[model samples]
Target: MVHLPNTPTREREIKLSFLSIMDIWSWICELPNLDDWSESPVFELVSSGQADQDGSTQSVHLRADRTSGSESEAAVIFTVCLQGFPPLNAEKPLWVSEKCHVSRENPFLPLIVQLVQEIIALSPNAPNSTCPRAQLQKLKPEPIAWVMDSHSLESFSTFFNLVFILRLFWLCACDAPNEAGSLYFQSLLPSALEIVSSSPLPVLRTFLVTVGIDTELCFMRTLGYVVAKLCIFRELGVGLQVLVPPPCRSPGFSYSTEAHGVWALKGYASMMTMMKVASSDGLKPQIPRLDAKESVLKYALAHQQLEALVQLEYSVAFNDGFIQVLARIDNIRLHVAKLGFKNQNDEAEYGEEKHFPSRVRIWVGPEVGATYVGGLSLSRSTGNAEKEVEIQKIVKGHFQNLKLSKGKAVARTSTKTKMKNWRMDQEAEGNGAIFDAVLYDNATGQEVATGRPYGETSDDPIHGLRRRYVGANRPFTKTGSVVLAGDEYGEEVGWKLSKEMEGSVLKWRIGGEFWVSYWPNQAKTSFFETRYVEWCDEVDLPLIPGKMIV
Candidate 1:
């Protein structure tokens, strides 16, 4: 059994060998604060031949751990540094003695390997960074392992590179082996969360600028990374809510210059796609509605913007990435389609699929009710008191032809033949079907409106007697007499006035509707004014024959 040295007293001036000074100097240099001292006496002795052991053993007495009572702790403070000192003047072994060797491999080698592997596996979860390298690697096999075998479960480790440390942290943080592993890394989870929620914007931007990288792409990627980490990671989900503060309204931003806008836009686009993927399992943020369809469309479109930018910026004009992005966007569009808001045109009566009752015309007099001419009775249902008046106006106009009923009653004309023929041709030619019905009145010599079978049109401009409205399927046909119909009476009167007076003109009337009338009157007054002016010149107010609004 080996004997260890006694602990020195606090104020003792104990004699020290040169090697003992070296031991003290080595320990001091390892101190974080004293690492810069290159000219100490211990360093000088090592540099020169004065303290060289030259294969001869030398005893180095060290005065250390004067305050420590524990032998194990005192050995750490005083003895280990000099443990490697070699003998002085001991004759070196002959170089050709390999044939006389007892064994080819050392038995301690396997122990060292196992020790190192254990250290690496456990050190990631260690509370402190410090670990004993010699005990793990068995660098000098003579000294006993510092801790007892049972306690040596606290494996040895060394400093690792930042990237490796981060990788290891993430790899283990995602899943733990046992209760101890889980408990040990529980403290580390919050630190990772803090980093995930932290804004690297300031530093990242500056770094990109210094490296001459595209700032827009950098910013977008940085933002995307933050969003992904916060939104998806189990540890960071709650903390992220605190980090990214929600804006009260949309902060509309536009680039004044093109310097690096394309790259930035691409990053935005990529992140959005990533967001969809990470939150695929019902963990995504709820996007609020904004002013225009284009605003949200722009957000969706931001991903594609980068593709365009790449083509424009690099002049490569390749499209593989763009095609993949388009496929992703198509998926997003399909999701938006289910919301039913983006498919406004699909619900429309004309121009596309007929979603409502079509060509619902009824001459309402004392004989017909409001439901036949206008729509289902609002007065009998959830009717607003104010909308009742508007419904009444529509009912009155529907039956104004009561006086002309006995004279030359207009025959209700339907486009059954034309619609049927069109459908037949569509089926035969493999073209999409046209479900819109064109209602006409032979006496009035004009088409009433375009409608789907299920949709109704109060008055569509499809039959208007104007140059722009002059198509083959137009509402109006040439008539011998200009007798006005119910809907066209005002325009006919204006037309008669214009013909009789050379300077008279007619214009379309436009005004507020029931729901948003107050808002339009307050904020959108200018739009109403401009429309009124155009209507006045074109139809209401008289215009000189040679003069026009343009």
Candidate 2:
């Protein structure tokens, strides 16, 4: 048994509340008595390095009653949060890591400080910036529990970059007569009439200069989210982007930019989301809606139930042509076939072989005239390809180890010799199949809104995201994003506006009905799934200066 420190109760309490000399609120500002609100972003780092001999550890932040009272140990977790950076090449997006910082300040610290100030101001007795310490006592700091997506530094950069962009939109509304920021704004946009691209990097530079945001931190915040070469697609009404906040942003959590200074936005998110859908099963699915002719398409409807991890961001922007929008569904995966179970007594039930759908189509845009962005036709998966691959692997390994005849070939296993439970994913690793996703209307029987599909890629654009994970290199096409369809390009990707709706306030309520229909390949069952998502709302569109209004 290990002997622990026998620290006195009073001594432990005193140390726990060391920062109590001044409450958290008082610590943030310079005593709050001076007329200065300068140096507002300050944080206290507390650590209790003491630990037990067995090496087992307990947190020091635990409540006084919960402690053993026999041992006095400090847990440096809080210190790590302040100073440490997350791991490199983290599978999940990391928000901020000390790994990437400039000078002494973490780029995220300022945003956190401003947000905390915003929250503090919401209390019944808000802190008076010019008031003395006695009056500052009214400001109570609310406890915040952080739920991060992953330990990815990208998350942090995205957060800061997003706030900077939303603030730009807020500036867009105010720029009409931006008296306070006009001098700086004019320098970036030579003529108020000259439109600036809404890309994150460009907007960040704009925010840094016009709003006096830190220069180094802005680029550092992007982590180069937008890859080069795709920037042109972004301009051609292809905002070619969509964003759902990173992981752990579950219900009850809200991400809003704090309105602190001239550059600050009034609680606008760079990511605008669809309001609550009137549908009965909004995100909660009852059962997969199977269209009999297309076979059973059991979609992994919830993130908790996803077969593979995926990150998605949807973006829509107005241009002179039409509305260009794309919802990037990364890590796309789907089940086309499964090994069938003949008897019910087995541990798990498998279905018959499912191949890639005959045709996969994507629709995204307003409810009435939804744009059919594109369609994909996959090669039939009815052959013995999977068995052939396995046989080749087994034969190669067997021959290599035995140093046997070079003429040896592995034969297909007969019915009795075959493993009863043998099963393999019908498609290849990443995306089992690859074919040109063309722009066509024949893929669906219903009356598609975007005129007729203009044949193939040469005719129109294939506005689909090619999803591939580290090991899953195959290009599998799944419909989980917004694919807008249009004829004459106006402000968006491929669609043109009606003659009546020009120069009008567009109500941007999007209802995307993703119909994944599959005819039989080898599997006899035929079914499809139609999922209606209120993909976006008018509230999602921003009020840009020259760009179309929300």
Candidate 3:
């Protein structure tokens, strides 16, 4: 603690409260005495229930004491209350819960405290402080590291908000190892998804990485674990999904920022995956997985998007959203290993997915030793899907048609009949380098290789990717208002109700069957999943506002 403001010299009273966090900030910013750290704001928080029997309202007053001498004291108090870090000030009294036990020290405490202290020092309100070079290096992985040479406390506050979001992320898995609906998890996930979905992609790309690698590392490990637990919520139709762009590593770091669109990847071990596969015999990884890296590389090379000889490996990423990459890889190199497992030329494929372990470069493009060189991936697509059991969910949608007496419902589906693909064949990449970089001046220093003639039509095989799902869209609709693929169709059922039941409540249940199939085109495994979905709804004769099924 470098410094703390003296005793409260001024007090600001907030007229409204009850934990309106964002609103409270607005109130604080608008305060006439805002610049004076000496001013402690008092907020009035009312109870959710009615007034007491005496006709007096039940309420509490919360005082925000920022930058006070009590900061360290408060930090310790909160840490103990949350049963977080067992502070050195253990002499302080606590009202421990009988049902809960602080059995062990929380490993998360040290990091969070460090982050908070760093955030406090960098915050816009703090007095001048020096950020040493060593600390800056420790804080980063890249372009952001250099940017932080100057401080911006305003943005630091955004990260501070994400602090609890990250906390709930890890704690939910801890509290309910088997369910995504734990108190902390279920409540926070929707809000998280909303923010991710609504925010502009540029904003997410710029700041999310700034939140620190701690968040990425923490959540990355929690990913498989959390996803494993999400099937528990399937019955409620609530799901959390994160789609990391399948990446292929070039063998080394990206050379220049122009290749910002390029991606390099590193493999990580998940604690959940490790524990799930652990057995009494010892540490044996008897798990099944889909190697997105191998699949992507194979797809790219098979279609001639990348040279057949340049090495590539699959990498799991921790970064921003959907990325637009240069569809071709024309230049590259590999340094075969001599001492490692790969150096021993262990080309055997193991595990259920039959994937070879990943390796880095030994000799790269410029005649380095055995290795693979490439850019890093930072794109992550995350969204949350929640279905609330509505009184009229069946007839509630943008395409709803159920109405007055005679109504129609459209259901679209597909079939794996392998309909003939009448479309033109997708062409591969042109005879060109992915970047505008001039590798050589006289062209004598450059190593050249023969490739298929460049195409004039499309980036299909490489630029836009394999176009897997489009081939699967089928069963064209016959009589629905909307269009559907030849293999997909919509069944509209004309519904009628008794006139007397109009003013009252009317309920109906419709059942439907659908099939989802995956072929082993580039996938390591394929299977058919038959899902039977039911649509149920209840409606009053006179439609309600926001409830009209049309």
Candidate 4:
């Protein structure tokens, strides 16, 4: 049977062993006092007897009791199971073989200190540096020569928590703008690059991948800012290997279905910010190369996350090249064809495939004519050759009778309907489809205002427009027009032109509405104003030129 040390004897021995590591103790004591940390329960060291013939085989367990908290709370924080005592003549007199188990919630103070020390070591001579070495050197001398010694379960969880804290601090420091606030960050970056490039802690890597798509916009914003700064400083390349380490870089990176959904939203947001910054700075946007594996589109579809797919569409709008990337995925065409248009509420709209309206509609109206001549439809097609042929036929049919003057088509859709005084309908009516229409200058192909169908309770037309036109890669010009079409005479469709005012205000007017009237701004953005006024005196509509097509 193994003998165990008495409580007082074990306590004395543990104290002696802990006190011998003067530098580590000093570092712990010097940690800045955080409010929550100060209030946390201190660790209580306990000694237990192991199943060994020698009484020397003892283990040390570190625990912290919950402060009147839930019973589910963890009581033990850490454990050090000593295998055996070192030989008396061993170079390291106190060295012992041991196994450590740390609580998932316990913060590994030693590892954190080591990371800070590594950073300080990298930049020992930085101006006004409060390096860890300098701080430790000022500590009181002890008899024992202190050496930094290198060393999970309930322990794995504790280690994960500790790693999380380390990553959070590092990320936060990198984001801090003030020099003093970023002192540690500035010192740590070089080493951070190496750590990330080399063997990053698995727990830390997992944390980043899993939470990379967190709902907290601030976290992503901050992470993106830091990433941009790193890129600007030439510390990181377009690969973004730091945020996505090699292990998690694989297409089959371990992520739950929920994680994929979160990534579909937050990951896209982060990537957009990164791409925008890179574009503005003239740096090559490092779009991740997922050619060998299933693309994000596949992940989104597998999870049945249509909203995520819609978000992807919005991302592609700002970056034209993304469309090409999307096109290369074989599954994309099949999936998109199978999945019809999603409405504002993300509900799928399924009907006759031919009647599945295009995501974008191009309307052409002559400056001199009362009626629109013809419209063009553009959408992702499963068959490119078939789509091209169909497009050519439609263009030929529409432009058959148009005469070009200064590269502009002077044409009308039809001459049968005569222009007349019309009033807007007071009650809002459904357009039957989301208005994802765009007006373009036929001569220059420059886009006008993108149309968004609005309901009576709808607000923020700009946002609505974004949702409708998910792949609009261009910014809205300063001045644009929104055209509305109605089914009835004197209650028809027309354009409302807007001019940019001082402080970015948009001044809108009913620029010769055939049947459409000015929509009121119910929310912050423009909405379709279907309501018309009482019919006024008749005005002569512009007649189609004799040579112009019907």
Candidate 5:
């Protein structure tokens, strides 16, 4: 429970209130004939007659309309005690209701009845105990009906302000569940859309601010979900126009950040989904024609100047908005490459340079067997090519030169040949090995140092070492060992291999020192073999190759 200095205790209270309010709004929105209820007036006041003989008291009747029908109405009769006047000031009367009774046949009478029943059901049974009426008075009907009937901008503005404050409080609260807030927003989406569509631009702007659209604390998931749902509706074009008003239509239109831009892209994605759904259902979808220059996706890719091109690429790749667009584009990788993306492997295929190191050192462990010798190599294309260079090698060895036990025969010649080239392509044909050493610095604890071959492009040097020495297909044993691979200088780099102890079952263990041997391009012989070598605890080298030691 880390608490910030600025966070107040009322934050949780405000968040719960917002969720309750939204839930209430959702229930009201889902009610049948809401538009009719909003227009038809739920309550009507009628005066019956004078209450007393002196006409000092009066009787007032209040009728509430139910959804059942206009003819069936609930009526509440109240006897008002007026102060010494026959004809009292009805509008601003100082009269108090003395007695009240509601009609039993009223269908609208049980709005609070269900809630009261629920409370009573939850209460514990006590012997001859009277339930307090004051406790029950705390429960009241939510003012959703009032909000729906509010036509004045001022009322809406005040309501928006309250919601805004509640949302702000929730945003600053550390314990608030973001998903809960998102769910509430999703539930109230229909009502929110209705409000946004009906409100004027100024009012809409205020409402947007209340929802944290232009604020630093904007809720992206909720906003995206609402906009996505709206995009699926028939008023797709109009909804987008309202949310993202074009600069030409309104010169003052602006967004605080690219958050809205990302959401707009999501909306576009949802629109595509809607179109697909419509097409599948044998219905025509009214697709809106958006200006390319004003488009969020186009702006993000073309001129947004994002700090990380990979981020934009990922957003487009994963975002629903760009799915159809990506499918339509023949060469999305090339398109992204032209947008100055260089970190991804797909972009590397389109790079100008094909120069790779030629002289390579191969390392192998005792698991490679005792019959063959092999090493790793590098190759590159001479001219412009579209293929990226390859790295990794695996070798299996075969044994030869056997002597019979019965006869005294001379030992036969042993030979080995290269089994597989990890990189078997024409692009790396002209590859020349660069004299770079792969060193692991124990002092700084760096896994792969800058001096390693292809260090700039390779992020995981330990993986490379594993592939080179452990014979790609071999399973790792529990014991630890060092395998070295080097250039022509014999200044080999070593990787320490060890099994993870926690939750690991050690099925096999290999002991003693050994070396990996291989014969390249040989006929009628094995390509790889693991031969016995003198065991040493550590190599007398200045730098290691891997971060972990066995």
Candidate 6:
């Protein structure tokens, strides 16, 4: 435990009261591990009005014990007696009551009920024994109902445990196994949602990101379990406009850092699953889903964005408001994921670019061994469909320019070939090497043209010109005829030429989507690219923050 300095006037008072509480518990309990409970059940009983008739009496007695350590033990003993057995209630010990007086506003009773039920369900007949972890699966309804109704942020028991209690409450509210319990749980969902949304506790919010990369809560696993249970809140319009709060400005491992990643991924997955279920059951909601973007997808690729990904990756982040950055990154990722593929891969293919004039090479799936289907798709003109017509006009103009370039190249090639053939004829009587002739519209530059003469003789032929010429601009022509027929006198005119061109067709096969693909195109690898540039731009590179991933 980190020791904090005692500076304020009330600091000593706090220390004294805390020590007295410990002493009281030490004297009254002797069952299991004493260290396990930092507090006494006796204190709980008295504070709730089950023991003390008046709150002031308990405070005074606790106060007196601080001033008189061992020297006035008798006086301290007397005060305890006065508090525990006021003459009017001497028959009852200081901590006895027929009914619990825990305030309905206090979160303690409901949390206690949850903890107790968790213990009972796991431990069964063992009244005083701690429950085993395996049996404490999901939370029970009684406690969730109590907490939902109470909805107070006051930490009556372990301030740390309040998050867990609320989390369990939300989980039951969303996923109670039975209708009897679910109906009651559903009724409390709105209240629970309100409590979480309005509460400013960082722990409470991070409790929704089960990954616990956010360091606010002391115990990682406990906080994670709490966060993993927010499926119910998500279903209740927990979009950016309603659920995520403003950024937190505090330092240290806060919830906002890791939460954004977990929430976006889980929530998106859940939403998709629910959509599938609703489609099958005919119960879909009318709410429109936002498309996921590459930038947001980058965030969900959890391991990569952890510090910036969550926050620990930056040394400067330790200076201030790092939690806010974490929250921003998270919300952005969530928003993108919510948008679905529309936000990520929605760019329009324009003009001849859709046909991929240049041969393209793409890997299949995420692995190399996964074989790819490769073929070329050509652009073609449509007669009257408005959009396709406009696109074809643009493509035709571009193809005309390409034809000119191709024609010029062919003219140059033809001249070179004729000279070589003339030299060969003079040297060897033109019997051995015959020059095949063809024409292409290679004009002013490398671009092909509107039209060209093409042919292949049985002898020497260049690779690009020898095969069938599929118009780079209009490969799939509406006329459905071969573009350039070979002058070969084969039985099947240009069919063999077409067969030879098959290998070069550019194929566009679909790949499985990545979270990054849901955001901006370059977002996956570039979210933190500028940060790195800034870091390197500094005269000295900072020590890789708190902990480096590797």
Regions of model 5 farther than 4 Å from truth: 1-220, 223-550
User: What overall lDDT goes with each candidate model?
Assistant: 0.21, 0.24, 0.24, 0.23, 0.24, 0.22
Tell me how far candidate 5 lies from the true structure as C-alpha RMSD in angstroms.
29.1
Candidate 6 segments exceeding 4 Å error: 1-177, 202-550
Better of 3 and 5 by lDDT: 3
Ordered by TM-score, highest first, the candidates read: 3, 4, 2, 6, 1, 5
**lDDT of candidate 2 vs native?**
0.24
Put down candidate 3 lDDT per residue, 372-442, tens digits, no spaces: 21322222122233444323223424333545445455554433322221111111112111111111111
**What are the C-alpha RMSDs, in order, of all predicted structures?**
31.6, 24.4, 28.8, 26.9, 29.1, 27.2
Write one digit per residue (lDDT tens) for candidate 6, span 1-550.
1011112222111112222322432332222232343433232212212224353322112111112233322121112112323334322221111121222343233333444344223221111212233444444445334433443333222222343234334233333222212222222222333333343443333333321222221122232222222332233333312323311111112222211112121111111111110110122236624434422332232111111111111111232322111111111111111111112222222101110011111111111221321221111222232231111111222345554533222111111211110000001111111111112223211111111112112122122221122445432232211111211211110000122222231111111111211111122211111101000000111212343221
Give the Å shift of residue 45 in candidate 4: 26
Q: After aligning candidate 2 to the native by TM-score, how far in Å is the CA of 44 from where it should be?
A: 16
When summed lDDT is taken over every stretch of 10 residues in candidate 3, the lowest stretch is 249-258
Estimate the lDDT of model 3.
0.24
Comparison by lDDT, 4 against 6, better one: 4
lDDT of candidate 5 at residue 410, scale 0 to 100:
40
lDDT of 1: 0.21
**Deviating ranges (above 4 Å) for candidate 1:** 1-168, 171-200, 209-550
- At residue 386, what lDDT does model 4 achieve? 22
Query: Which 10 residues in a row give candidate 6 its minimum summed lDDT?
Result: 529-538
Q: Tens digit of lDDT per residue, candidate 2, span 1-550?
A: 0011122222111112322312432232223322233432333222223333444222111110111122232111111111111222111211221221112233225434343233222211101112121222332212111212222333334333233332332232233222212211211111110111212233333233332222212222121111111221222322122211121111111111211110111111111011222222232346846454321222111100111111223344455644444333222222221211123222121122122221222222333443332222222343342232233223433445666645544566432222211111112112111111222222333322222222222212121111211123222323222222221111212233333343344333321111222222222232222221111222242223254421
